[model samples]
Target: MPITTNGIHHEERGSGDRTIVLLPGFGCSIACWAEIAPLLDGYRTILMDLPGHAGSVGAHADGDLPTLAETVYDACREIGLTRFIVAGLSLGGAISMRIALDHPDEVEAVLGIMPWNAGGTSAGDPVIEGFNAAYGDIETITAGITSISNDPTKTTDLLHTMPTVTEKMWRGWLGGGAFTSMADKLPGLRVPAFYLVGGKDFVVNQAKQIDDVRSIPGGRLVLHADLGHLACYEEPELVAREMLNFLDTHAIAPA
Candidate 1:
């Protein structure tokens, strides 16, 4: 069932004490975390759609990363999560970082999958141009994302939701208009941070991600050479195990 969080669409599951909030990548729904959510066996889980995608499609317009973060924060508060961990992929990863940065006291830990270093910076030109060219046409945009994805067929639903994604979302989220340099923020991070970088994710710079990890007091980076951008999709079980262990290590109690 779809519930509202300050009018935002979200879903909740699990019955554990500590909660894990899962935010998906572009055009993704709570379904994006299906394979991994179960691995988080003993914790409460909340999965959400960003403003312009999935269940929350078109709920808000002209929103920036921080704006989206606030929406999610409001949702979390409504869901009654006093102490929780946040994890995301791509766009979600960027938002997770924002959440951790802005509310250090609330977010217990963070896990990012190909997350961007959110501030006044963007990825390479090729990736930016690709989205710009396919902005209005759903077919074109879906095809573009499918081409880079590790498993195109698995992401069909995400592709279908592409049409709802707005140009502002494209420019601000994917096209890289939103940013806050992590170089200066990581050292000051209050939680444990982990990044999983795909070897073939051409959109993000692996080197910079590693550097971001180095800055954190105890951040760690895991690289998978055979994987592409949606690495979690390619080997969800493996990634889930890793995610579970990382959380367990940092978690006050085992989930």
Candidate 2:
């Protein structure tokens, strides 16, 4: 794992034909992608822990979406990744969207999994708030995440390696100011994109969000009826396979 001054922790694997940057959701560390990354062994995968999460707990910034996007961009630059597919879940998905909109030259494509549109309410807001209230209380926070996670055992194992996050970071996660503002910028984004959602997700309307994304030329949507908010974890192998297929359709060059 490599660490950046801005408090981003990342692990890289399989220097293959394509570079796939994986970003986790709010309060989640890079380990969230543990099951998913290995499945992408034929491709280069970079799993990143956003600031204020995991080993990067003290990492600080404006804590807004744009700043988060820049932080990701900086992390990629620090590691010499200029062009790659940026895939994100939940909050990470929103950040990926911002990156695609603001720095199209650096991002070849975006995979947004259970992404929250800034204009809508998050389905798991109550759960997130309750967890944040117990930020330093590791047990409480862990329990909260497990309740929402598709696989409690795997998620708990991953969380055990990280320190408790702060209330500020939690606030940043819930604040959709950055995501909501992104609607205005979407029209300008030309990158090939994939919008994925779990059919059971109640945090946001999958169909509506997909409709919004489809307004963009070449945008595609995928919905898994058996999954929910944490679809990547619930179906890592399937998601990884679908991701590779999407990339192939989009013609993303291998690294």
Candidate 3:
């Protein structure tokens, strides 16, 4: 795995003209992209483990969103990618938004999955609070992840393969502060964007999620009715097809 200054670990594949950067959610690693990557074989893809997760343990800078976004930007710069389409899931979506907002010149488009939007408190507040409360115990946190993942067996296997983090690291990430700060910046995005959410995602209000991103000039929403928060895992082929179509429609360079 290649390492970045901010402690992210990544794997690069393909040699296409267009680059697709995959950012996983909390507690997940590059392994989260296992199913999606093969579908994007024609495009250059970069899958990264966020700090303190998987191969990037001990690389945590600040749990805050801006710092994490800068880390992502640095990683992309290090890899010689001047611009790319960023596709992020959950927490990754929040980071992608920050990157798109802070580095518009380097972002061609954004695909936000179950994204956390800019709002101090909305219908999703209780969901976030529940997550924070559960983060007090690692077992609880793990269980929560398993409950939400589309494939519990695969998700558990992937998680069990990673290096463990301290309670503080887990708590800091799930405490909700970082997401709150990230969500507060949604209204300022200027790039073309796609917002995706599983139709069955109870953790986030799908209607609100769509409405939030729809407010952006060129943003549109796509809902996978049969999937949940882990839509990518539950419906990789469908998600991949939708993403590829979006890219094609936006005239994003192919890998």
Clashes of 2: 5
**Candidate 1, superposed: residue stretches over 4 Å from native:** 61-63, 119-124, 175-182
RMSD vs true structure, all candidates: 2.3, 2.9, 2.8
* 1 versus 2: better lDDT goes to: 1
Q: Which pairs clash in model 3?
A: 16-255, 17-255, 117-183, 118-183, 118-184
Tens digit of per-residue lDDT, candidate 2, span 3-107: 976677888877786799999876667766888888876789999887777766767744577787888788888988988889998878888888888888888
For residues 1-255, what per-residue lDDT tens digits would candidate 1 score against the true structure?
Answer: 575645567777776877899988765677778877877888888888877776776466344777888888888888778778999987788889889988988999998987765433554456657776777877778778778788887767666667777667766665544444546777888888888888888767777788788888888788878667776566788778778878777555534
| Candidate number with greatest TM-score | 1
Arranged by TM-score with the best first, the candidates are 1, 3, 2
- True-vs-predicted CA distance for residue 30, candidate 1, Å: 1.7
When 2 and 3 are scored with lDDT, the better candidate is: 2
Q: Where does model 3 exceed 4 Å of error?
A: 120-126, 136-138, 158-168, 178-188
Model 1: colliding residue pairs: 118-179, 118-180, 119-179, 119-180
Candidate 2 global lDDT:
0.74
lDDT of 3 by residue, 163-243 (tens): 264445566655633455444456677677887778677666676676677566777777777777777666778778888
TM-score of 3: 0.87
State the weakest 10-residue window (summed lDDT) of model 1.
116-125
The residue ranges of model 2 lying beyond 4 angstroms of the native Cα positions read 118-134, 137-143, 158-163, 175-179
lDDT of 3: 0.72
